[model samples]
Target: MAEEEKPFICFKNGWNMKIEPRNRKGWLYLSLWMLALLPIVFTFTWLMNRELSTAQSAAFITGFTLVMIGWGFAMSRWMKVRSEVIDMNLMIDFMREREAQKKRGRR
Candidate 1:
């Protein structure tokens, strides 16, 4: 028998850290992110050309990650079922578990 398809708008892979679009809206959002990518890279490159310190680079990465996390939360909230959004906390927990496993393997 064929496997059933999930109704997730965005399918997030915790292990590889990729968010795949599962629906039209998800695809649209993905396209938007792609469009924004060029300017984001350009700005980062421009700033780096100005010689940002290690601390500033670290701060930028942290802020960008937080923004992505917030985007994930927003995407989760975009679709609700029985007054419930996607459980981002669970997704984050899974990602964290994967990271921990990688760290353990390295030791």
Candidate 2:
């Protein structure tokens, strides 16, 4: 039989915490992208300071610009995904609270 999936939970100050997995994933991806970009950026900067043929400089500049644009796009996507995750988590928390209130009222 398949194992039951458990909800992600965090406990602090005797209270349960609800964390959105999507937000966590988004942050993880963003961090990974940043780590991966560090070396590429350093290399680009090093190349820019060196003497190079016109074609090589142009190529480096174009590649660097494209990388920056991609980074921006990734950041924007992470923001959007994080917002959506927060909204969904809020809804889930609301429902859980409502259910808890109903159970208390029945007692």
Candidate 3:
């Protein structure tokens, strides 16, 4: 019964609040994000490697990294909002199914 249920993201049991995708939907989102980011990252790296001096490259990379981090955080939050809705609905469905199974098992 448990094997049939699948979720986009699974909650990790730990002190750190980390969430990861467990199914194809999650993988798709991650893959798309990586695809979107790859070109920009490559462009930055290429430009910095060839055009910037050592100190300049360091500064550019630092700034770029910080901006990318901020962008990533925002994207994650947006994605989380969508996934959480799906997760909540799935949880409700799972609970309902479990209850139905229990009632059947009793008969």
Candidate 4:
């Protein structure tokens, strides 16, 4: 069965926008990379606490996990915003090219 296509929702003025399918793949890859950092963060925290006392090591690991989780969320949001900007720029360039083509056609 074919899946229905969903339109991208724009926050300002409740506009419905369409993004190229190829651009969506970029977003998926970005999200995957962000998720992949979780295990790495866990391993790093565990490795860093090996020399500390049991209680101290537990505290350090807990603190590190919280900090890493917060950092990951922040970085994910930043990357998403950056990708949106790139998509917007590409859209603008495409529109300009289309207008130029229309003008050339009328000549």
Best by lDDT: 3
What do the candidate models score in CA lDDT, each in turn? 0.60, 0.66, 0.69, 0.59
List clashing residue pairs in candidate 1. none
- Clashing residue pairs in candidate 4 are none
Q: Write the residue-wise lDDT of candidate 3 on 1-107 in tens digits.
A: 46443334544333333556667877787778778888778878777768667898888888889979987897677566544333455567799999999999999
Best by TM-score: 3
User: What is candidate 4's local distance difference test score?
Assistant: 0.59
TM for candidate 2 is 0.44
lDDT by residue (tens digit), candidate 2, 41-104 = 8999999999999999999999999989988777555544444323445667899999999999
Cα deviation of 73, candidate 3, in Å = 0.4
TM per candidate comes to 0.38, 0.44, 0.57, 0.34
For model 2, what is the error of residue 1's alpha carbon versus the real structure, in angstroms, after optimal superposition?
24
Candidate 2 regions exceeding 4 Å error are 1-36, 84-107
Model 1 residue 42 CA deviation in Å: 4.6
* lDDT at position 11, candidate 3: 42
Clashes of each: 0, 0, 0, 0
Q: Candidate 2: lDDT of 14?
A: 28
Model 4: residues with Cα > 4 Å off, grouped in runs = 1-51, 83-107
